[model samples]
Target: MTRMECRRSLSAPTGTENDTRISTHENESECNEIPQSKSYPVFKNIGTSQCLNASQEVSDTGQCCHPSLMGLANGHCSNVLEFFKDIPQDVRKCLVEFLSSGVTDDLEIHEGNFHHFFHVANHLNLRRLLQCCVEVYEKGDKTRIKEKIGMCECVHYLEQLVATAYRRETSVLWHEKDLDSDRKFQVLFLTKDKHARKQPVVVIDFARNFKIYKQDIEKADKVGVGFCACAFEQDGCPYIFVSGGEEKKKSQIWQYDVILDKWSKAGKMLHGRSRHLMVAVKDKIYLIGGQNVACIEEFDPISGKCVEIGSLPVAAWSSTYAVNNDTIYIFGGKNPAGCISTVQSFNCKTNRIARLGDLPCACSGSRAVVLGDFIFIATSEGHLIKFNPMDGSSELCALQPFIRRHFVMFVRNERIYITGGVRKSNDKGADENHLYKYTPETDTWSDVATLSTSLPVYTYCTVRYSGKCIIVPFEKFR
Candidate 1:
């Protein structure tokens, strides 16, 4: 029911002055009361009257307006029309019908035709139609829309439309200028170049069709033997902290800024460690058992310092763990007596350790990931154990198809993905390059895809970045 008024000065041969006005309505029924029924009127100051023709071209810019006018000022033209040369005829008809009736009954917008509608409506200056297109874009699925629109295409146009329509910025599409939080969740696999000895962190945007290419991502700086890595967020920025590997005396912690894509020395762990586990709870990192060190240390990213919080009651190392409710669940690991089926819980709040129960078997080199209320442990013996932490009850969930040790386990979209492990055998296991997917709903496992390279056991770590699985491999991929 709202009407739009436009005023522009016009020069005529007789020096006559006049003003033109435009009226538009949300309801098409209002147009019936005008002198010309079902037709839009375009009145000019130069005593010219014309009916708005959607298909007619009235300007060199290929815009439609009063035929008598040489040009129209920005927003001064009553009717903004374009031929929609590239658009399909049905789509063109839909747009023209919307302009005439202001009804969207036949305006079917979807992923396939969104770009066409957006370009046509934007070019014609149809703000209402453009707003509709933006709404469709906003309500789309994040991963799907990202794949369709790409990361950079038409983002500014959408931004401008949102600003004009809503008077505020909208997070409709991700832009390079957006904050790190706006970026998509990514998975990173750190691999070393054999020739140059440089570590190139492989970034995986799993949501973008789960595509991986080594040449597409830039190379990270040369790093030492990285034992384990964990991602932590500090003051709204994301970072990956890598602990040194193998050298017993190597305690340097390298911090990788996810936003800046740069690496530098964050600090050193309290003790030189290898075959350790690093987990982030809240803002602090807990580094547990490495090599001969049985003490657990807490690292503060802000202070760049590590403090010995406590130590494991028994000698335990090479075990996989997961954190829930501020408690670290340590599964079976090796001791002076060899592999033990010990399931222990360490409370972060009280800094206390207690024995929960024994794992199904003495799993020395296994991987564990938490899906829901249960912790799924993939043992090197080809057994998948499901452990319920609430009552410390454990049972075998399923059998792994591949009997592999030193593998990486991660969860995405309520499903588990394991990649880059060494095949368990008597003669020093061989590296595995296949990625396997486990669906808990059906208790099934399937080999989905093969990785570009194999990720060895202690050489890689997994963390969730923005809720997406990120695998940080610290070894050279053969």
Candidate 2:
């Protein structure tokens, strides 16, 4: 799967209102009833309706605007708020009821009603209206609304609002596995930048697309989470491999169908092989070396078929492989007999394999990520090696704070965050608690923020999400 790019389709919200008004036909539907126009600003027949605009003062210029947008038009203040400007007494009560007295709603700096309202409020320096922007956006999921927001003085509005715990650079926070014990799921992820005015952090329900459902996190009777292979199918969403574990295990390859909210079992591998590593390249998932000297196999997700792809130089299992450009490069992994520092590369274009330089240490489970033209390999002995595939030349950088083997290193906002792995002194145990960020520009590692969410990295701990690295913490699953 290539990648799902975030397309900024939001149009700047305009202050102008639709001049093309529909005359009062007085039609009623669940959507809205007694739709009001300037001809009659107030309607007693309409039970309760929230007024989106507060422009009490009508400009005879016959120019209708989102009242907030008018602030940018003439920068003049008058008794413009007409009689109908207040969110209608009944509607006002409901809107107030929706808000937390202490929690002021903030808007996505550039989009939506509140985002624009906040902009006008800020231009006039009205602190109270500016605060309401937050809650309004949170009450509405931003990603879903990003495409509809009109671009209006969004930058100026963002400058004044308070910042929160949310990542300014992220447009979306993907919920990987939303399945309850009932075996349900929702999948997909995306992000955005800070200064850009965006929507509030509101939860969404994939079960009903376009309709939000409140799903309480359910407690499972018994969790059977274990080592599994992951690959992209259908579109770019990820699917898990429930087979390819130990032999004697009933053959099954369960894939989580995110959009449909279901699971599918693909055909089994030739035989079960535990502690095996999986990597997807050129639309096909390669079940690389594994325990029991398992043969490399190519899985066609479309057909649910597994075809053998020869074998690795060593009978290795659980090694890290990084996909760079058109090639999938395998780093160190423990061969069936022992841990090896061997390096191998498979070219997608040529469909052939070749060997590269040996890692400084014979470590398995560490991650190899391709950034720019360099592949950075970190090991269980706290060793960080930068290798170039073009000439097979490698340079060692300052090591990690602690040693880990099966951690996930992925890119976000152009920064690489390394999460979770195991160590040798700990045997098959891993304490992937420490998260590190490496800035290739500075060739430096800095500890940014750590996930308070506990993710255990046990013997079979592996993190993978289509188009991103697998992030986890240390754990002992016994």
Candidate 3:
């Protein structure tokens, strides 16, 4: 019963200043008849001079006492916690008082009490305890703090560390509201102008939501070309089929149905479409650019046909596209003549395609995805371009890492997952079933889980269902 009570009493921190006297007497005693009830060894080690001073905190009956130290020279130390639950309250108080401000930072007074000490130090926001924590961590192995809460570099002194850390964590979560919904919105501060910047961003696609709708998401009514079977899916897939087929007839704009779990029909346009840029805004899908022609068309997958929205101010198909609110940005696409860095955009509501800006370098077939507010343009030839929509201006990301691939992909989950695609470079030529995952934290790409087959590079669309990213085989949309 006494042992159980002692354990319960020590569970809470106490500041006992007594218990030091009689400790030496017990240590030097040759008497084997001492009663077990009062023979605990915690107080039996103090020498005569210290034992006398220790008695000042003892009660009149010679029993241990707990009292705040007043005018003892140093300030009152934080309550040091005991790791063992069964310790007597008197002992816990004595230990805390002894190790208060006077204790050495590098030494552990009690063995096996590290966790209790650290927890209490963190909770009380004590500087001395924090210093002790840092010392213990430095003296011990890295595994000690490997999986700890608020994990990070340790401070040398505990003084206000615990209190400061709590406030920091609380504020960090305030800026992370949309993070839980798997949707993020960020504004880029590139020195460019003349673009709409309103749209919910779906980033880190592989780890979260599946599909794309931003920038130029327009709803088309009964729009298709030639023969139409009809394939329109919900939130439809965000993936775009921007690849230009060898023949003009091969390049096509298609949409995948995320809900129906199949790719459906989108209206074919009057002109033969190849190497076109497709972006969804509001309720309409804008198919921009084609080989030997700089024409743009809007397709209504529900209607199963296309309408000539307007022609781009430039002559190029297969141009790289980025969308910001109502604008479908076209940049760095090769014309029948050669590679051009011309920038253009199609406003869905305005019904027009206008030149916006130019690229830092003339390149095409690169991947452009939004991270935060700035659009990160990774060229097929391995150059990173940053374009600001507000004004038509772009710059090269010389310090950023670049991975080149031909397949069109999306930005989601803070990562840029690139599936299999052809690459042509002497130092980095890749043409296999390549699946790569990149972490923006380290700005590096590493190989992870791979797909059974290379992503279908249709001149059309693809959808991810359950855990499968299925691409509708696009022999013909109509």
Candidate 4:
């Protein structure tokens, strides 16, 4: 999809209140008397007889004259017509009681009020109302409310309610799995200065909020730009491996101890390859597709040895790959002829590569991640394609116009976040400074947050450790 089309689809509807307003004549016939129920404690305090008489008078005369309910009869109560239009009679009555009260101390009251409020808001397509609820919960004082609920508890409940409403409304588009178990993880970024040729590893801890710390690694001759890095476990310890970027340098590999904050040499690859992709499957780390290399190399961390296992059908470079079960799926890269759209799956058990299918378009320097049963690839053209390996089918689903060459894509919890790529425009815009989030369940793209520093296209390596995203820059800071 083009950028304009994507924006139109995501744009909010306008003039909803004017188009769906309920007439005062209809209100007179329908809501003549406020229902008498235990759920409506606010009405009891106002004196039911007096409240009903006032409601009837206002509904009939179209004038909110009652002093007691003047506030409700004017602003808040105006929403009742649209709110109750779709909601069931029982739910509407209960909601009216709770919302009319405006505040409550009972846990059940809080739950019931928010539950139906969300439903009503969704039914009316009141996105602003939902957003207001979130904003109020985040920024408003919880202590001032009658419920005495903690801010954290209120936010949690609000998220749950929204998720439930999203599922009910968009079941087909919604992802079945919940991300409640996903925790915040720290990110490690390796940045370089082009002029001085200085590379420093920066660690960002998001677990206890976001904090950044930088550490300098003992630089290697070959470890500069276009190098491949991935997080792997040796024995039970976690470590990061960096390998093969500079052609003049030998096939040297370096390992960094994440816990000790130290760097050391590891086993070298058989071939000096740059712009390759690395993923750890089970006990072995597999490096595939880079520059002129067609051969797939596997490194055993335990033995500190590297061996060539398989070769691609053609020489591929700058492609992205993700692992599922025992197979690694690689997609989109440039060959000698130019960019290719081939998808290849390498099965570890068989020790062979098989052609799965092709991408919708040829893409190089793209990124891929496995979520559930599908492998999602973010293309250089800013289109997101999901490939189902089971049936060998590929479909273009989402569009992100800012994704150009050299961007990094990673998944946290269940959402995919893309950072640091150039924009597809004549200006050669600085998209590297922004971070975008792709929600698979909704097939929408949104700008979430900005990065501390802009990343050069295809000059950085990213890995997720302990639920955090770590970035290592290979290009000079612009």
User: Candidate 3: what lDDT?
Assistant: 0.42
- What are the lDDT figures for the candidates, one per model? 0.57, 0.44, 0.42, 0.54
Q: Alpha-carbon error at 461 in model 2, in Å? A: 11
State the displacement of the C-alpha of residue 126, model 3, in Å, after optimal TM-score superposition.
50
Task: Give the candidate number with the greatest lDDT.
Answer: 1
lDDT of 4: 0.54
Runs off by more than 4 Å, candidate 3: 1-266, 398-403, 407-409, 415-419, 426-478
TM-score of each: 0.57, 0.50, 0.43, 0.55
Model 3 residue 341 distance off true place after TM-score fit, in angstroms: 0.7
Instruction: Please report how far candidate 1 places residue 16 from its true position, in Å.
Output: 53
Off by over 4 Å in 2: 1-226, 236-238, 247-251, 421-434, 458-478
Worst 10 residues of 3 by lDDT: 469-478
Number of backbone clashes in candidate 1: 0
lDDT of 3 by residue, 241-354 (tens): 221333234434445332111233443566665556666665666666666656776776557567886888888755666668777777877876788888887788888667
lDDT of 1 by residue, 161-205 (tens): 555553212211222233132223334444454333445444443
Ranking by lDDT: 1, 4, 2, 3
Sort every candidate by TM-score, greatest first.
Answer: 1, 4, 2, 3
